[model samples]
Structure formats: C-alpha cells, structure tokens
Target: MARDRLHEMRGRVAIVGAAESDEVGRLPGKSALMLHAEAAHNALADAGLGAKDVDAVLSTGRQTANDVPEYLGIRPRYLDNTQMGGCSFIAHLQHALCIVEAGVAEVVLITHGESGASRVGMGGGDRFAPDTPPGQFEMPFGIGGPPTRYALAQARHMHEYGTTREQVAEVAVSTRKWAQRNPRALMRDPITVDDVLSSRAIAWPIHLLDCCVVTDGGGALVVTSADRAKDLRRKPVWVLGTGEATCHSIISQMPRFHVWDAAVMAGERAWAMSGAKPSDVDLAMLYDAFTIVPILALEALGFCKPGEGGAFVANGRTAPGGALPMNTNGGGLSYTHTGMYGMFLLVEAVRQLRGECGERQVAGAKTAVCHGTGGILSASATAILSTER
Candidate 1:
C-alpha cells in the first residue's frame, strides 16, 4: 500500500498499552538498553501481554531491531528501525499501523530509550563526514549545535512577526503550570513570564526555561489491530491518522526560518487523513524541544495562522483552563526530555484520551493531536488519536 494513503487505516489499528520507564528525572545507574527493556516490560504488562505475545518490534536510537529483540528475549517476524531523531517514534507508530493493518504483525511493540543526562555510552559525532556541507561550511564557523541553529529561526520569527520575548516565555510558563500537577515532572515550580525572562539565556531568544529539560528515561507502546485491541487489557486509543515528511538535514538548507514547510505538509496530510479539522481536536501534544517549536507547530498544524502563534499562546490558551489544552503532561519543557521526545508525546496523548490524567486532563477529551519535530525542525510527523471506535 502507498504510504500517503493512510486514511484507509482509520479505526483499523489502535494503541492498547503505553508506559514509561522508572522515574524520568534522573537514573545515573541505568544504561540506555536497561531503560528500553524496562519500558517494554511495563507496556506489555499494561496490555496484559508477555514478550511471547509480541510478534513484531519497532525502535529507534542506537539500538537496532536485533538489539532490542535480543535484549527483550522476543523474536518477531517484522521489525522496523526508522530513526529520524526526536520524531522517530512518531514515524514508527505510523509505520506500525501500516504493518498491522497489512496483516503482517498481530502485535507490535514500539520502544525508545536515551540516557541523555548520564550520557553513558551515548555516542556523539558529526553525522556528516568532515568534508561534507555541514562539516566544511556550517560546522567550520562553530554554528553546529541545536540551540545556535534554532536561535536563527527564533530570531527571525521575532523580527518578522513582531513576536516579543515575553510571548516566547509564555510557552514555558504555561507548560510549567501543567507540570505542577505531575508528580513525575522534573520541574514543577510555578514560573512567571518575568521568571522565564530572568532565567539564564541559552541563545538570544531561547532562555534556560524556554529549553526542554534533558533527563534519563524511556517509554514504550503496544499497538495491534483494532479487532485485537478490544480483547486486550486496556482501552483502545485509535490511530485516526498519521503523516510524516522531511524537509532537510542541515539547518542552512531549510527553505524558510519563520515557517517549517515540512510541519505544514505533514500536519495537513494528517488532518486530511483523519477527516478532522483543527476545531475537532480536543487536546494537543506538540513536541516542545524548545518553546519556539510549539509556536511554529501551532501555526504549521493549522491551529492558527502564520505569524500568529506568538499571540495564540500568549494569553494562556494552551494552559490548563484554556480552550485548547496542550501538553497536559508538562511536556518536554517541564516533564522530561530524553533526547527523542516523540514517544512521550504519544504516551501523554493516549493517557489523556483514556482520561487517566487526574489533574491535567482535558475534561471529556475524545480526540488528540500529537506532533513531533526532529533534527532542528528538519523532520516532522503528526498523529491524530481518538477514543472513538
């Protein structure tokens, strides 16, 4: 089947189980592989299944399909290793839906783990060779890291849209409000815009609070055919639609700084596939690797117009009491960011749809939209989930 034709997948597959590894804030003793195994076990338990029940496996990061299967002691007929950074998990979920709907896998386990805080065995180096464009041109000037590259876009957004520093800081302040209700959140203290502005600045517009917290953690999901999910342990969170796209690998190659073209394309496809408009969405789990990301995503996802994201989030619309509740689980900014945050986004969305979030739940939420950005806003993926059949 063609990848673009995901609308046919609606109500065909559902997420039956989801879980995170041990406490997210810190785990100095745990290796990345250990975290992955823990999450996989937890998710299987949540689904009332054992490793033997899983006939397929999907994962990202340094771990290959073979690595995960070997560590977990399960042999699967199908395996997927689609790693595109933070949004890799989102893409994996999308692929798993197709795999299951095609009758290739009865039950699939998608997992993610990163010892970002400990950095124990976390390999790092330029993805490109020394003589490549990034190595020869961009890296030579010392403008390599994510903060520097994202700052260029944030600065441009501020200039083009007259977006203020306080408007950007509002994202942090609002997300922290949700974090206060989550016991597992790393940073739950209440923060005002003034507090965010006063915090140390990482880049010009990106402050310490504006950036996502890096911790050691892992998360996993159990997906199966809708027919099979109904017989499983937990309520089904249907995969209504999914879309993914890659714009560029290097920041310099991006078409526009103010707008993420890939996000726009991906979101539009997801919305179309789900037959859902922005108004139909009850909640959002947009990847907040940085405050600016959700801002751009809100626009690209059609929640608001271009250049209007600053105002859309300024008045607390994304806060707990707002019309459109977003990142109800503190999000990457305040919750936990273990490098690739896409898996957590789906986990929170599933919980929200299940009405499991005691304090931060969007009352009567039936539909959710989870969006993820990978590699300096280069790769984008969007998933629409609902509790409806």
Candidate 2:
C-alpha cells in the first residue's frame, strides 16, 4: 500500500503577510498605485517586518497599477514586473520561489491595483493597446473589454454543452449566499437562481447578473522563507506548489471554445509539485468573473467529471456548509472585480488558512487552493497553500 505523502513543503516558502484595501465602490482621490501601496504597507505591518527587510518586489503590471518595490522605496536584489493577466499574482508566487531558490532574494512582495469603477483604462489609448511586444490578438478586434469577451465565451459554452440559462444562474445564487455573510462584499442582497435567469441578457447566454461588477481595489502579499515566516508575528501559510500555463490568444483561432485546457495544465502541475490531490484541498477560491467561467473550470481542474459540473455545483454543493466551501469572500461576482480579480483570491485564501475570517470562515481549513484565469481563458495559474508552517 502506498503511504500518504508528507505535507510536501513541510513548511518552506510561506506567505507571512497579506492584505487588501477596503473594497471601494468608488474612490475619487486614491490613485490606483496609492491603493496598492497602502495594501503593501498593511501586509508588511501584519508580518511585523519592515520595508527594508524585503529583498525583492513582484509587480502585477496593469493599465495603471503601481510597482511594488519602487513605491515602497526599497532596492531589492531581485525585481520582476510579471504582468500576465489576472493570474499574474499567482504566477508571481511561483516566480518568487525560483528567485529565492536562485539566492537572488530572501523576501518578496507582490501587489496589484486597478480603478475599473472609475472607468480607468490603461495602455495609454482608447483601449488596452499593449504595443511593446504588441498585444498580438487582443487589442485589434475590440475583443478587449472583459464583459464583451466573456459574453462571447459564455455563448460558446451554452452552444457546446447544452448548458441551461438556469444552471448558470445557480453559480451566482450560490456565491451570493456566501457573499451575504461577508462584510467586504460590494453587492449582497439575496438572489435566487431564478432571479439570475430572469435578469436581462447582456448577450445570448450572458445576462447582466452573469457578469462581474467592476470596482477600484487593490491587494498585496509578503512572502519569505519558512524560517522567516516562523519568526514573524503571524502564522505562515506554506506555498506548497504553483503553476502557470497559457493557450493561444487569437480568439477566432483558439483550439476549442468548450474547454479550458490551461486550468488543467496548471492544476495538474500544482498538485504534482505539492504532492497533493483534489481531495486534499479543504476549500477553493476559484476565479469567477462570469458565472460560466467557474463551471467550465470545475471540469478542467478535475474537481468533477467533465460535463457534470452543472450537477456538481447544483444542489447547494458550493453553499456555506458545502462539501467544498468555495469563494467565501464573494469572489469577483459579489466582492470586487478590479481588472485583475485574481490577486484578491490569493489574499482571501491566505486569510482563510490563517483562521482570520470571522463569519464566513471554513471550519478547520488546513489547506486551500487558489486558481486564477487570465485574458479570457488565454492564461491560467494555480497555487496550493497550507497552514502547517
């Protein structure tokens, strides 16, 4: 008989600190970077560590996001401006470990910010025009805005899977139930699955409620060696494993519209590296920009049999007292949807593992999994964390 694998990291690379600014529905004076810096300061303070102790900074490049190290006034031995989309923050976790292993940095900082509620668009033009390497397939077709692009993806999902209007609504209803218990959520009243089905469709198979709300918010995290985390003021949530992968971005030319292969690729890598399995994770903080994204991701991530996700998340399986407690912070659906909602998932995951969540907390949550999808299923990332450290 095979023996259970020991907690893979045994408490190695740990998240010593994490934070996010208040979910501002609207903030006039706070620039995007200022909010980011504020979160960074809070995280550093939570860890009982100083800015000077940070040896590297990981910035999530946004239309107007700030640099983590530059704004903090630190000269780290390592620096990474990794801007890969919503999943970039999780990607930064993976990148920071490599940097630390290479002896380039001892402590790392990751920060993300955006003012989407203010209609703040980056790239210095009418839309997101990333001209440096050139946004090969993103900018030209007006396939740029998240809502419009998600509409296209949702349409394809229904076409291929026989996915119903009611089933998609279930995702929102279930998450909203959890959101009602969260004080940080921006939209919380109580929505039934029928309410979602009745809402006006933004596009076919894409209702107004199906889309995520845009807000101006930012989040940050401080990572250090297991040795450092144990010495810090707070408990350490070990980064057992992480992975990132991308598919072709050319929407018209994508291989298949029905599946999310990136999530599979990244999920398998993260699980293997951590020596953990789907059953090992007690909770999941899935990136839910649209109702349909998580349904597809459940299959792609191997949480359920392909094509059975509709039933998996049905029957209150993802509700408060769920078999697998999910999106306890309301997620992008009810919480906040900055340009990159993915970073917020990580912040919430760390908080859950630390048992810091008050009402919506998952009981005895020893392990957590964070999944982020970027650029309309163009890229994906995964991270497994535990509180053993």
Candidate 3:
C-alpha cells in the first residue's frame, strides 16, 4: 500500500503532530478560539516547532463570529477556511497538502474548537442560508434541528431493514465500553444496551444517549512534507490518500432507507488511491456524531453488507476488545465532541498509527482508516493513513 501510494502521489505529506485542549460538556469562561490557539500551540510544540515555524494556517470558522487565528494572534503564509461543517478537518488536510505541494506553505496548521453548549443567551438565530433548501423545506415544519433530522433517518433505516432499538443501542453501549478505557473520554459510566434503550428519547427512535454530547473542546494537527517530518520527535504517519463526497443537505433529499452514499463513495476512492483494503486496517477511527452514523459507515466502508451494520456490530464486534477496535479514544460518542467530530477522527487515527495510545492501542497498528461525516450526514471525508516509511 505504501509503495503504491507514494508512487501514485506527490512528495509524501505526514501528520507530524496533534493536540487537544481540556474537554468539558460546557465552558463559558474560555472562548472557542482560545481553545483552538491552545491546541495549535501544543501541536507545534509536539512537532518540535515554534509558532514562528508555521507557514500556513487552515482553520474552521468557529460557532462564534471571530476567526480562529484572529484570536491566536498568529497568521501564516497560507490560509484556507473551508467550512463544510465537521468534515472541515479532513477537507483541510487535502487543501493543506495542495498548499505544501505547490510550495505555498511549508508547515500547515489546522485547528478547530467549539463552545457550542455555551451559546445559551445568544441564540443560533437563523444560521442557515435564507434560501438554503433545508431551512425553507424543513425548518418551517417544526422539524427541530439535527437530532430530529437524524431521527427520521434512523426510523427509515429501521423501516427498510428490520433494525431494532437494541441494535442502535448496541452502538452506544459499545462506544461507552471503549470510553471506559479512555481517560480523556467524557462519559465513562458503564453502560448497557438496555440503559441506552431506556434513556429518554430525544426524537422518535433516538434516545438521549444515542445523540452525541454537546462539548467545549478543541483539536489541532500539524502537517509537513516527509522531508521535514524526519526532524520531528515522533514517527510520521503519512496521509496516504484523502477523498470527499456529499449528498443533498436535507434528510428529505436523501433517498429514504438508503444509508449514506457519500461515505461509501469517499471510502472507495480513498482505498483505491491508497491501495489499501479493509483487511489492511489495524484500527478504525470512524466519526460518531451519533451511534447510527458509524453503524451506517461500517456497512458503507465494506465492513459489512448494506443491511448488516447492526448485526455486524452485534455481540460485541465494535465493543472494547473486539475484532476491529474503533474509536479507541472513546470517540464523539463518549470523548470530546467539540461540534466537529472530524478532527477527533483524524487525531485518533494519528494516535493509533504513532503508537501513542496506551491501553487502547491496537498492537502493530501499521495502517488505519478514518471516515468523518459533516452536517446531518450531508457530506463525508475518508482518509487512509499508514506507518510504513
């Protein structure tokens, strides 16, 4: 895979450093941009570089009005603000690579943070585009927000394939089981499928536990060309391939009962570009915006058949000590969510490939696959990373 990948692409780019700020359910004291700057500085320090070494800045627009770097008091030779919601992290990786390969930047700093739970008084008053089809077609119908929109997808998945509440709960339960081993994970309470099933339902077919936690946290990663990575402290994990795909924004626009085509499309493209197969992945860091998202992504990524995602993870396939370990850092299900789960996905994959994870480490994890979803399953980005030099 490494040989074919390098032969196919430009000079290799490596994820040399990664970092995260303190995570909490809510933090009103520190703003979102502060977290981003902290994570960015730590990431640079991890890479054995100073802010002065950074030549590029790639940031996601925070839920707040100000941009991330504006608060950090730092700028770079390159700047990219690609905002597709959560997938921004993975998409930024692609854009950063282009900047580096084009000699526009030498060191690309990608950062993200969110105080989504702290925005209590300041309402999210109409963040969507006025002409956005989702707002016009769905918002006026008392459709609530992303939680309810995903609930409709869950119901449709259940209707098309005889998936049960326990199957969905299985995802939540399995994630919590893993979270117990992850010290940084937020919700570490021992949980069961019954507990998840019995948790208060946020929307029909979606329990409170099924929905992701609102979190205040930040994540950052430093990307540099392979020539420069050898000078860094840790072993470099090459971003072998990256791909993105998207469906219509609204839940109504997607085909009823058809799970995310974007994930599969991007997954296939990444695999083909990197010359990696499912069997080659030692670990998986799939985005877990909701329990259902990873369940659906597993099937789309060819971990199982279309209708077998629930049964695929049944009897502890995705749980701790399972065949293929997923979200070893607890994931969005249990770990810091910070609005964009995509950064977590990339960070976890790098952690695994670098052999940084302590107890949850997948032994001999030379290669890994990470998939991230943005919006209400509207878009997806897939990446295959390898430890091979």
Candidate 4:
C-alpha cells in the first residue's frame, strides 16, 4: 500500500485562553500599551496560567514584540512581530503551532490593542500625507482612506456579479441582528436595508453602516500543546488548520478587484489541512473591514461560488438562528474594531468552540473558520478550529 502524507501540525497545538481587554468601546483614558497588558493578564488568567509560564509572545499595532514582553514583564524564549496588518495574529497562530510542536515553546501569547477611536499614542499626522506615495498619486485623484479605496473593488464586484446595493446592505443588516444580542456590541440597536441605504454614504457603494466601526479595544490568546491544553481550566480550541498568503500592498496594485485570490489560496490550504469541507464549519469569523470583505471571502473560501455571495447571505443565512451563525459577537461591524480586526476573529471563534457565548451562541457550534484580511485586501490568513481533536 502507498504511504499517506502527514499533516504535521494539525491538532498539535490548542488555544487555551481567549479574551478581550477590560473595555472594548471607546476608552480615551487607556493607552495602547495598557490595553495590551490588560488583555494579556485576562487571557493568562483565563488559561489559569501566569505570565511567568509564557515562553513566547506575539503582538501587532504600535506595540512591538519586544515592547510587549518588557511591558508585560515576561522574558519570552521566542518572539514574533509579524504585522501583516490585521491578519497578523492568524499568522501568529500558525507560527505558534510550529514553535510549540517543535518543543521550542511551552506557552505562547498573542496580543493586539489599538486606540483606533481615540487615536491615543498612535502615529502622528494623517496616514495618507500628501508627501507620501499614495498621497502623491492616489490622493491627488480624490482617493482617500480605506472606505474610498475598498469602494473601488466593491463597485467592480457589483458590476461583474450584478450585485445590487440591497444585496450589499443585507450584510450590514443581518450582522446587526447578531449585534443586537451582544451586550458588548458598539452599534447593536438594530438596522434594516432601508436604514442602511438611507444612511450617509462613506463611499458610493459603501455606506457608514456597511463599514466596520472605529473603536478602542484589545484582544489576546494563549496557545500551548494540545496535551497541555487538555489539562487547562477551559476546553482547548484545537488549531486544526491554518494558512496565510499576501497579494498586493496597495489597493491600486491589486490584480483583481471582484475576488480576493489570496483568500482563495489561503482558505484552500486551511480546508485541505483540516480535511474538512465548508459545510463542516459551524461558524464563520470572517474579517468584515467592510461588508464586501466577507462577501468576497465567502466565495473565495468555497462557502459559495464566485458571484453567488450576494445570494448566499441575502436572507440572513449568516445571521443569528440561520444555517450558519457567523460573527456571534457581532463582528467588527457591530462589535468593536480597533484598526486591526483580525485578532478579535480568533477570540470569538475560540469562545464559540468553548461554548461560552450566552445569547448569540450557535446552538452547538463545534467548529469555526476564522479568516482575516489585512491592508487593502493585500494579505489574508485562514484558520480552522474545532473542539474535538
């Protein structure tokens, strides 16, 4: 008989803890470093382990890897600062698995915090200064921040797929339905397609409600060997599969606007590693920097065929009590988004797999697929997690 190839890192490591900072909404008083420390402390406590037990650290945003260790008062044997925009933590999980599986680190902590709303201690001045590259070219042509830049791609999708404004607005409305159940959600009042359509337009096709909220928050995760995780205080969310890929840095340079090819490649690798199909996923924590993001990701991830994403999510299929409950914490759209929304994706996935979500919880969510999109659809990372080994 022919020998079978091995999935070396599958189910080798598990997330022992996942938590957000003390507060997720606007907190002008808290600095970026403070959020990191608070989230780290909370995650460690969740794992029933202290900072002293951590041998590796991963972080993003203004906080560097070395900065986090010193601030948290831990001396990590290994460290990573893989800041590929928001999806950095997903990539961190992949690296942490390798580190733990190789016996290099017993415990790994990945942290993320950003003062996105208050802009406290953040980089000074406008991100797209007229003197900068994008400013010199894109700005002069009326191209602005992410909403405007990403709108170009969303507009393209509408043209090619015959996707209507109502189809795109459905994403925002359905996601809000989930948000209404979450007490921590920022904009959980509830919204409708008409409300979304009438709302002020940030860009042509992108409305204010269609975009993710800007908030001040942080999140952290604790990863260790699956064996060690089994003995922890909480159920371990196994890292069944992980994949990452990068496309273009700037939105203008992207090869395609309608579909994110990187997500297709990354999601394929993750599903292949887990040996599971899209139907196997109980929940999906897709990055919603904008409504179009998850729509395209759904197609790229094989949840639906390309150009069919509009129909896939039209009637609240991804909303609460639907076929697939997604972003039960309300997601970046209704939940808190501190610039890099990637880490929160993993946090919610872990919580769901642990059976901790109260009202918005999927009835029996055992598996989740968390995906992140960084930059202007430049980078992507996909992770498949499950409760069972």
Give the lDDT of residue 241 in candidate 1.
87
The TM-scores of all predictions, comma-separated, are 0.97, 0.91, 0.93, 0.96
Q: Which ten residues in a row have the lowest lDDT in candidate 3?
A: 2-11
Candidate 3 TM-score, C-alpha based: 0.93
Q: Judged by TM-score, which candidate is best?
A: 1
Residue-level lDDT tens digits of model 1 in 1-389: 44566788877899998999967868988888888899999999999999999999999887656988998998999988887889988888888988998889989999988898997656666476688877877887777457888888899999999988899889999999999989899998899999989989777788788889999999999999978887887989999888999998888889999999989988988888889989999999999998999999999999999999999997889998988899988999999999999999999999999999998878999999999999888999999999995
List the global CA lDDT of all models: 0.90, 0.79, 0.80, 0.89
Worst-scoring 10-residue span by lDDT in model 1: 120-129
Model 3 bad stretches (over 4 Å): 1-7, 63-66, 120-125, 129-131
lDDT of 2 at 220: 88
The Cα RMSD of model 2 versus the native structure comes to 3.7
Model 2 over residues 1-389: C-alpha lDDT tens digits? Answer: 26323234334688888999755556656777777777888888888888889888887655322355666797877777766688899999988777766677888988877777775433344334566222555666565456667666667777877777788788899899888988878889999887888888676677778888888888889998876666789888888988788885545544677788888888877887887787888889899999888887888878987777777898778889989888889888998888788888899999999888999989999998899988778788999898863
Q: In candidate 2, which residue ranges exceed 4 Å CA deviation? A: 1-11, 63-67, 119-144
lDDT of 3 by residue, 1-389 (tens): 43333225532788998987756567787676777877888788888888878888888754432355566666666778777778878988877777777778878899977776675323354555557786688878877767788887778888888888899888888888888888877799988888988889788788889988777877899999888898889788898877788876667787544588888878887777777788888888888878888888888899888878888888888777788888888888887787787888888888888888887888888888888988888888888888883
| Model 1 spans > 4 angstroms off | 1-3, 123-129
lDDT of 2 at 385: 90
Deviation (Å) of 367 in candidate 4: 0.3
